[model samples]
Target chain A: MSRQTDSQSTTKTRPVPPTLSVITEGSPLSFVNPDGTLTADGEAHGIDIELTRGLYREMLLARTLDREALSLQRQGELNLWLMCLGQEAAQIGSVAALLPSDMIFPSYREHAVALYRGVTPAELLVQWRGLAHSGWDPRKYNLQMAALVLGTHTLHATGYAVGARMEQTDEVVAAYFGDGATSQGDVNEAFNWASAGSLPVLFICQNNQWAISTPTSVQSGGQIFRRAAAFGMPTWFVDGNDVLAVHAATTAAAAHIRLNGGPALIEAETYRMAGHSSSDDPTRYRSDEELESWARRDPLTRIEKLLRLMETPESFFAELDESAERLGAEVRDACRNLEPTELADLFGNVYAEPHDSLEAERRSYQESARALAGVNR
Target chain B: MSTMSLVGALNAGLRKSMADDDRVILMGEDIGTLGGVFRVTAGLREEFGADRVVDTPLAESGIVGTAIGLALRGYRPVCEIQFDGFVYPAFDQIVSQLAKFRARSGGRVSLPIVIRIPVGGGIGAVEHHSESNESYFAHTAGLRVVSCATPDDAFHMIQQAIQSDDPVIFYEPKRRYWDKGEVLDQSDRNLHEARVLREGSDCTLVAHGPTVATALAAALAAAEDGFSVGVVDLRTISPLDLSTLEEQTMTSGRVVVVHEASTFLGIGAEIAAAISESCFYSLRSPVLRVGAFNMPYPPAKVEDAFLPSVDRVLAAVDHAMNY
Candidate 1:
C-alpha cells in the first residue's frame, strides 16, 4: 500500500516576528491600512465597493450586540459573555465570503459569525443566560453551536467535509478557532487529517494574541500558519483587523477548496480588545500600550475610516448608527426576557431513543415534585 | 440460521448494515486494507469500496472527531477505537462532543455514530491492549453502551447499534471474538434487553461482554455441586434493562454481578445497587460482585489471576448462597 506522502519540506526554520502583534516573518496581508488608505495589494485585489460597505455595516451590528451583551452580563442578566470585541473583521469578512449553504463550526467567541448567519439575538443570548446549553438549530443556519471546548470543533468540520466529498458537493466547510486553541492536540490532528484526506475544510485561526492571560509569544514556538505547512496544507497569513483583506483571502481560499484543492489554513493576526470574558481581567496580564495600539486598528474603526474616505453619504452613517442602537436594544431585551429551561424539558433530548433508566428517574422525580407541591398547598 | 464466530457475526452485521443503508460507513485506524487487527472489518473495504471503509491515520481522536463531522453531514459513522485503553485519547470527543451533540443542539441534531472498542482482559496481550473500560462510557449521559457476549447477540446488536439515532459505544469482546454460536436471521429481542441464558431458583450470575461466557461456565460448575445458578447476559450497560434484571433477580433471590473490570465503581456496582433497591424483599443475600482487583490490568502471565475466573465467580456465588 502506498503511504500518503507530502512534498513539503520537513526542515524547520524559526519565524521571526515582524512586530509584537504579528507572528510571521512578513507583515500580515492587509487591504485597508491603519491610516485609512488601501495598500497596493489591497487595491490590486479589487474588492467590490458595495461588499466593503456591507462589511462595515455587519461589523457595526456585531459590535453593537457585543457591547449590549457585555453590559447585560455586568447587570447579571447573563451568566457569562465572551466578548468578540476585536475580531469582528475576521468573523464578518470570512463568513460573508462563503456561500449561504456552506457549513460553519465556531469555537464559542464567533458571535459575529452567528449574527451574520441569521441567528437571532434571543437565540444567541439564551446560552449565556443559562437557559439552554445551545441556543440555535445548526441545520437551520448551516452554523454549528458554539463549541466551548477550545479546538475540538475543527475535527468536526473536517469530518463534515469528508462527508461533503462523498456527496460530491462544491460546498466548503469552515472552522473558526483562536491562537490559544492551536496549542490543543486535536487542532493539529484536524490539520493533518484534513490534509491527508484532501478534505475541503478551511481552518481560520483568528490569532487574537491572548488566550485569557497567555500571550501568543509564549503560546507558540513558531508561526501558527507555519505549523500548517508541516502538514502540507496551503497557508495564508492575513491582517484579521482588515475586513477587506480577510474577505478577499477567504474568497480565494473557499474557491480553491471548491475547485478540489486540498485543505487550507489562514492565520488571522488580530487582538482581543476586551477581556476574555465577563469574568476575566485583561488589565493584570496585558499592557496599556498594547491595548492602545490595537484600539487604533479596531476592526469597526478601520472600515468606518475607509467608508468616510470613499465619501459615503452621511445618511448612510446616520441610518447605520440608528440601526446599531436598535440591535443593541433588541439584544438587551432578549437577554432579559429569555426563559429558563424547564426541568421537564431537560431529559427529553439526552437520547434520541427511549432510555429506560432516564425515563424511570424522570417519572420518580415528577412524583416527588407533585407530592412536595401538595404539601406546600 | 447461520453458525459463525462472534467476530464473523460482527463482520456480517456491518456488511449488512452498509448494504442496507448507503450512508453507513466505517472509519478507524487499520480498518480498510488491514481489515482491522481483529479482522472484524476484513473483506469490507473490497466489498463496499475504500470510500465506505476508511483506514484513518493512527490518531484515536481523529477517528472519532471526524466521525462526528460525518454524522453532522448526515452519515452514520461506526468508529473503531482499536483497543479499550486507546479509547481514552478520544474520551473528550466521545463524552463531550459525540455524546452531547444531540442534547447540546436541543434535539435538533443527532449523531448516529457508533464507537466500537474491543474490550476486557484475558487476551494475554501487552499493556493498554486488554482492559475493560465500559463503566467509563456507561457513566456518561447521552451515550448508549452495549456489549454482546455471543455470536447471535453480536450479529444483531451491531446492526441495532448502527440503526440507533443516538450515539452508541459498542463493546466487542476481543477474547471471545472466535467463540462460535448460531445466529438467527432476525433479532428476537430489543437491543437493550437482557437475555436469560439459563434459569435457576437458587442464585443468578449476571455478566456482559467477555465475562458472560465465564459466568455461564461458573453456572455449569455450580450445577455439578447441586447449586442451581441462573445466568443473565446484560446486553446493554447504560439505561440497563432494570425490569428484566429485577424479574430474573426475583427468581433466584440471590445475585452475583460479574465483569472483567475492577469491582469498585464498575457496572457491577450499578447492578448491585439497582438490584438491591428493586429485589430487597425477595433477596436472600446482599448482591455480591466478582471482578478484577481495583488496579491496572496486571501482566499477561498473571492475567488469569487478575481477570474473573470460574473459581472466583463460584466463590462469589458460594458467598452469596452462604447468606
Candidate 2:
C-alpha cells in the first residue's frame, strides 16, 4: 500500500492548503482574486439572477432554521443541535444539481441540503429534539437518513450506485462528508469499490477545514480529491462558497456519473462558521484571525453579495425572511407537539419476524403497567 | 428432499432464494470466481450471473456497508463475511448503521440484509480463522442472530433469514459444514423456533450453533450412564426460543448451557439467566454453563482445551444433576 503511493513524496511535499478555495472563470481558469470577487466571465457562464435569488432565499432559510434549532436546544426543549452555519453554498449548490430520484447519503450537518430537498423544517429538527431518530421517510424524499458515523455512508452510496448500474438504470448516488472523514479507511475503501466497479456515485466532500477541533492537515496527509483520483476516478476541486462553482461542478459530475463514466470526486472547499455542535466552543482551538478570514468569506454572505449585484428586490428579500420566520415557528411547534414514543415501540420491529424474547419483554412490560394501574392482563 | 452438507445446503438455499426473488443478490470476498474459501457460495456467481453474485473488495466493512445500500434500494442482499474472527472490521456498520437504520427511520424503511458468516472452531485452522463471536451481534438490539447445527436448518433457515425484513446474523457452524443431514422436502418449523433434539426427564442441555452437537453427544453419553438427558438447539440466539426453553427446562427441573463463546456474556449466560428467572421454582440446580474462558480465541493447536467438548458439557450436566 505504501508503494501504491508512488507520488507520495511529491503529493505530500506540495502544501495544498487543506481548505483552499480557488475560483476559476473560463478556459485556462483564471483565479478569483483574494478579495473574494469572481471574474465577469465566470459570472456570465451560469450565474443567472433567478438562481442567485433562489440560492439566497434557501441559504437564509437554512440559517434561520439552524438558529431556531440552536435556541430550542439551549432552551432545554431539544436535547442537542448541530448548526450548519457555514457550507450552505456547498450543500445547496451541489444538492440543487441533482434529481430527486437520485439518492443522497449525507454525513450529518447538511441542513441546507435537506431544506433544498423539501425536508420540512419540522421534520428536519425533530431528530435534534430527541423525539425520533429520523422524522421524514427517506424513500419519500429519495434521501437516506443523516448518518452520524464519519465515512460509513460513502460505502452505501457506492453500493447503491453499483446496484443502479446492475439494474441498468441511469440513476446516480451522491455521498457527502467532511475533510476529516477523508482519512477514514471506509472512505478509501468506498473510493476503490466505486472506481473498480465503475459505479455512478458522486463524492461530495465538504472541506470544512476542521473535523471537530482537529485541523485538516493534522487529520489528512495528502489532497483529498487527489486520493480519489489515485483510485482511477475523475476529481474536481471547487470553491464551495461560490454557489455557481459548486452547482456547475456537481451538475457536470452528475452528468458524467449518470452516463456510467464511473465515479467522480468533488472536494468542495468550505468552512464551519460555527462550532462543531452546540456543545463546542471554537474560541479554544482556533485562532481569531482564521475565524474572521473565513467568516468574511461565509457562504451566506457570499451568496448575499452575489444576489445584491443582481439588484434583487427588497420584496423578494422580505418574503424570504418572512418565510424563514414561519419555518422557525413551525419547527418549534412540531417539536413541542410531537407525541412521545409508546413503550411498545421499544419492543416492536426488532425483527420483522416474531420473536419469543421480545414478546416476553412486551408481556412483562404490560403486566407491570397493569399491576401499577390496578388492572389484570 | 436430499442429503447434503451444511455448505452444500447453503449454496442450494442461496440458489433457491435468488431464483425465488430477483432482488436476492449475494456479495462477499472471493464469493464469485474463487467460490469463497469454504466454497459456501460456490458456483453462485456463474448461475446467478456476475451482476447478482458480486465478488466484493477484500474489505469486510465495504462488503457489509455496500450491502446496506443495496438493501435500501429494495434488494435483499445476502452478504457472506469470509470468516468469523475477521468480522470486527464490519462491527460498526452492522451494529450502528445496518442494525439501527430501520428503527432510526421510524420503521418507514428496512435493511433486509442476511449476513451469512461461517463461524465456530474445531477446524484446526489458524488464529483469526476460528472464533465464536455471535454474542456480539446477539447483544445488539436491531439485529436477529441464528445458528444452524444441522444441514436441514442450513437449507431452510438460510432461506428464511433471506426472506426476513430485518438484518439477520446467520452463524454457520464451520466444523459441521461437512456433516451430512437429510433436508426434508418441506419445512413446518418457524425460523425462530427451538427444536428438541433429544428427550429426557432428569435434565435439559441447552446449546446452539457448533455447541449443539457437543450437547447432543453429551446427552447421549449421559443416557448411557443411566441418566435421562434432553437436548435443546437454540436456533435463534437473539429472540431466543424462550418459551420452548422455559417449557423444557422447567419440566426437567435441571439445566446446563453450552457454547463456544466466552461464558461470561455468551448465549450460555443469557440462557442461564433467563432460566434462573423463569424456572426458579422448578429448578433443581443453579443453571450451570460450560463455555470457553473469557479470553480471545487461542491458536488451533490448543483449541480443544478452549472449546466446550462433549466431556466438558457432560461434566457441567453432572454438576447440574447433582445440584
Candidate 3:
C-alpha cells in the first residue's frame, strides 16, 4: 500500500507539467469501449487483467449494496441514500489506485470507497438512517467523515498534504468531489495551494454529468480538467465508465506526486444513473433520451463485456453473484439493527474539553425528560 | 517579568508555544515576513522558518479550511484572520467545519486550532477593519470564544488557547494592542474564568476585551461620585463562568454589561438572561446593557461616539444604581 520510492531522477525533482495536447483534446481518454475492445490509448495503457477483474468484483459489490440501500430508503427503513449506481468505476478505480495509508476527504456520495476501506454497512448506514451525525471513526480508516458542504474538503485534503510534506511523509492526500464542486472557490484555492507548494495531492473529480439536475455543460464554463490547467496542475480527462482508465491515470498521478511532481487533477467523466438522492426527482429536469444514452455506456456493463471477452470463467461470475446476494442481506439487517441514539449522547461530544454550559444544558434536559417520563408512565 | 505591549506579549506567547511544541504552526495573510499588519507576529517567521509561519494566499476560507486539515494531521495551527470584518469570508469554514468537526466525528476528531481575530472598533480605520462579531461564534454550541484585554492576558491566553483541545475563537482587541502592561512569567488563573478587577458594594460593571478598560475607568468615576462600583473582566464568552457573574450580581445587587458589539442579541443579552434566571431575587435592579446601537459599524471618524465609552458605562451604572 506504501508507494515509497527509493529515489527519483534529478529531472523529476521539479514538477513536470501534464501533457497539454491530451488535456486540451476534448475527447475523454477511454480504455475499455462498449464493443468489448480496447481503444488505442487503452492498448498503450495496457490493462492488468487480474487487477481489472478485482476492480469489476468491487464494482459489482458496490452496485449490489447501492441497490439494497436505495430499496431500504424506498421502504422507509432508512431516511435517505445517495446511489453510487453508475460511477462505480470512478470511485473504486481511483480509491484502489491510491496507497492504503493515503488520507481521503470524500464528498457525501463516495460510498464505494468507504466500503472498500472497510467501513461497515452499519457504520455507513447510521448517518443515512438518522442514528448519528457520523458513523465511522476517520482515524481508524484514514477516511474523513463525509463532508456534506460541497468543495470544502478539497482544502482539507490540500492542507493535509501540506502537513504530511512538512512531516516528510510520502503519502499523497486525495479528495473525491463532483463537477459542481470544481466551481467552488475553496476547490480552486486548493488547486492553487497544492500547485504553489508542490504538495502531494490527487484531486479526483467524478464528473457525473449532472450536479442534481444541472448538466456539466451548465455547471462549468469548460471541461472540469481544463480548470486545473489554469492553476498549473497536471490535468487528465478520462472515461469514468472505464475503470482501467481511471486506475491507470490515478496510479500515474500518485507516482508523479510521490516523485515531487506536485498535485494532479483527473476528471473522470461518468453519468449518475439514479436520482441525486432519495428525495430528488431527476426526471423533472432531464430527458429519458439522455438517460437511455448513458445506460448504454454503463461502467459495469463495459467491464463485464471485457471480462467475458477475456473468457473469465462462469464460476467467477457465479461466485460474485452469490457474494452480492449475501452482501444485500447483510446490509438490510445492519440497517434495521442500528442502535437508537439517546438525548444525553448529543451533549457528550460537542467539545473535547469540558464545557460547563453544555453540561448544565444536559442536566436540565435530563430533568425535563424525567418529568415527561413520570407523566407518561 | 517584562513590561510589554499587547502586540509584543502575543508575539512572545506565540514564540514560546512554537518553541515548546514542534507541531504548533502559524498561518495567515501577511503573518509571514510581514509580521502581520499590527506587528503581533513580528520576528516569528525568521525564528520558525517559512514552513512553520506560512504566509497563505489571500483567501480567508482557505486559511481556516486548510488549518482544519493541518489540525487533523496532529498540527496545532493558529490562524490569524487579518481583521474582524474580514472574517466573514471564512465564516462557513469556522462555523460549519472547524466548530462542528469534533461533534460530527462523535469526538474522535479534535481540531486544536485557534482563529486569532483582531476585533472591535476604535482605531479610526476604514470600513470593515473594525468589528466585534464574537457573538456569532459564542452563540454556536461547539466553539469556545475568548477575548484578551491586557498585555499579560494576551501573553498567557494565546498560549493557553494553543494548548486547548477544543477549537477556540481568540479575539484580540485591536485598539488595545499597543497598550503596555507587565506580563508575568506564568498565569495563575484558568483561561475561561472571569476576574474581578475592582471590588465595590454598590453595583457591578461587567465587560470583556476593549470594554474592560472603560468599565474600570467608569468604576473609578463612580467611586469619586460616592458610589462603590465593582468591575469584572469576562475573559471567556461562551462557557461564561456564570458562577462568578452570579456572585458579583448578588454581592453588588445591581449589574451593567457593556461591549463594543451591538446590544441587540449580543453577549450582554445572554448574560442578562442568565443573571435573571439564577439571581433574580438577589438583584436590587434589572441588569442593564451598554453597547453600540443596532447598525452596521459606522465610518471610522464616528466610532468614538458609537463604541461603548467610559461615559456610556457610567450612564449604565448610574441607571442600574438609581433604578
Candidate 4:
C-alpha cells in the first residue's frame, strides 16, 4: 500500500495543545482540586455529594462484578470476559448523566452502564457465558446492546440521533468508545455525519490510554478532544478517574447537545489499570509501576475519601458492600445454572418470519441428530 | 418510464428514497459539493441540501460507525464507500456492529442502513479501488449482500436495500455504471430471488455484478457454437437463491460459476457446493468456476486478465460440458 505521507507529515508538523484548557479554566464542572480537597463551591452543592456517593457505590459494584466475571472465565464458565476493572468511574459517571429518555450506545466494556440502565447482572452475564447473543432487549431500556467493534456504534448512534431529530423528539443519543477507537476511520466519519446533520448526539470517549496492546500515542498524535473541534463540535476533557468530574462533564455536554441541534464530545482522561480483557496480560506491554500510579487515583477511593471526610455513617458503607456482595452471588449462581441452549433457538429468531430454506435445514439437522441419538426408534 | 445507465438509475433511486422519506440521508467523503467522484450523488446536495446529502471527512470506518448511531436514532442512512478496497477501514463496523445489531438487540433494534460500495475489477483503478470483497459480507450472518447487474435492477434494488429492516451491503458494479438499460416505473420483483437473464438447455451459467454481463456475453458466444446455455443472475449474494439455481442446474445437468473475486472461498465456492448437494444425481459434470486466482487483486495494468472475462466463462462452460 502506498503511504499517504503528505497528510501524515502535515498533521505531525501542526502545533497542538496538550489537552483541553477547559479543565484548567475552572467551571462548575470540577468537584475536587488538584490537592484532593473538596471545592468550597462543590460542598455547597448538595446534589453533587449525593451523585458522587452514588457513583462511588456503583463503581465499587462494577469492580466486584468485574472480578467475579474474570474468575468465572478462569473457572471455565465463560468463553471470554472483557474486564472493565479500571473503567468503572468512566462508565458509571457518564451513564449517570443520561436522562431516562436518552439512549446509550456502548462498546462491550460498559457493564456499569448496563446496570445503570436496569439490565440485571444475570442478563448481562448471559452474553459472555455463551448462553445468549445479547444481554437484554434495547427497547425495554434506552441502552442499545453492547457493540464489540471499536468505533462502529458511533455511526449507529449518530443515525439514531438524526432519526430522533427528524421526529422532533427531545431525546439525545450518547455513544461510548475508547481512546483506541479514535484511530478508526469510522470514528472520524461519525464526527462528520453528526456535525453536518447537527444531530443531537453526545460522543463520549473513555480515553483509557490503550487499545489492547497498542498505547494511546500510537493511536493518535495528540489528545482526541482536538479532533472534535475540527469536526465543528465543541469538545471537553475531564479527569475520568474523578467520578464527580466525569458526571459533571458528561451532564454539561449532554445538556449542550440537547439544547443545540449538533453533536458534542467529551474525552475522559483515564487509565486502564487492568488488562484489556481476561485473555490479555498487561505485563507484556506495560509496567507494574504505571499500573500502581493509576490505582492511587482510583475513582472509588477518591469518592470514599470525600464521603469519609463528610463523616458519612458507617452503615452507609456497610449496606453498599452488602448489596454488592449479594449482587455478585446472584450473578455467579445465574452464570453457573444457565440452561443448555437449544438448537432450534438459533433459527427461530433470525428473521421476523422463518425463512423457508433455514427451516428446511433446521428440520434436516434435527432429524439427523435424532437418528444419531437413536430417538427415531 | 425512462432509460438510464446503471449509475444514473441508482442516483435516481436514491433521490426517490430521500424524497419519499425525510429520515433518508446520504453520507460519505466527497459526496457533497464534489457530487461523488463517480458523480453517483450528483445534484443530490442541491436537491436535498447538505443535511440530507453530507460530504464526510475521508474516514471510511467513521462514516460507517456513526451511521450505526444514526440508525439507532431511527434515521435511514445510505453510506458510500468511494470504492470497494477502501472499505477495510470500516470492516469492524460493517461485520461486528451493522451485521450483528438486530440479532444482538434481540430484534429490538433494526438497522435500516444501506452501505453502497463500488465493487469488482475492470475499472483500471489503483490498489484498493477495484476489489470483490462481497464474500466477506455475505458470510456474515446479520447482513444482506446484493448486487445489481442492470439499470432496472439497480433502480429497484437500491430502494429495496434501503427499505429492508436489516442492514444491506449494496455492491455497485463500477465497470457497468455507464451501461444503459430500460428501467420500468414499477418493480414487483422479489429482490432476493435469482433471475434467469437468458434461457438454454445444455448448461447453466451462474454469476452476479460485473460478471453477469460477462456470463450473458459468453452465453451468446456459446450459441454461435452448437452449445445452448442458461444464465442465472445471482443478485443476492448471501441468500444465494439456491432454489432457483437448483432448478436451472437440474434442467441443464451442468453448471459453471463465474465471479470477479478470487476462486477460493468466493461466491462461486458456495454456489458450486449448493449445486453439487442439490442436484447430485442430475449433474452431468462437476461444477467449474471461472474467477480471479487466489492472490491480492493484481495491479490495474493486469486486472483485465485477472478478471473473469467472456472467454474465461466460455472456457469453464466447455470444461463442465465435456464431462
Highest DockQ, which number? 1
TM, every model: 0.96, 0.93, 0.97, 0.85
Per-residue C-alpha lDDT of model 2 across residues A1-377, encoded as one tens digit per residue: 11112112211111222222222321222123234466653644534566566666667777887888889889998888888888887888788777767789998898877877767766787788777888888876778889898999999998888789888888889999999888888999999999999999999999989988999889867667767647988777877877766766676678767765599888888889889999999889999999899887777776666566667778888887788888788878877887777767866655565666678779989888878888543
Q: Model 4 over residues A143-192: C-alpha lDDT tens digits?
A: 78776767777877876776787678877789999998888766777788
* Fnat of candidates, each listed: 0.92, 0.74, 0.83, 0.54
Candidate 3 lDDT over residue span A266-296, tens digit each: 9999999999999999989999999999999
A86-205, model 1: which lDDT tens digit per residue?
899999878887877889999999999888888889999999998888898888888998889999999999999998888888889999999999999999999999999999999999
Cα RMSD for candidates in order: 6.4, 7.0, 3.6, 7.9
Off by over 4 Å in 3: A1-22
Ranking by DockQ: 1, 3, 2, 4
lDDT of 4 by residue, B103-200 (tens): 66666667788999999889788888888999999888877889999999999999988888778899999999999999999998887889998777
Each model's backbone clash number: 0, 0, 0, 30
Error of 2 at A192 (Å): 1.1
DockQ of each: 0.86, 0.72, 0.84, 0.45
> Using alpha carbons, what is the TM-score of model 4?
0.85
What would the DockQ be for model 4? 0.45
True contacts kept of 4: 0.54
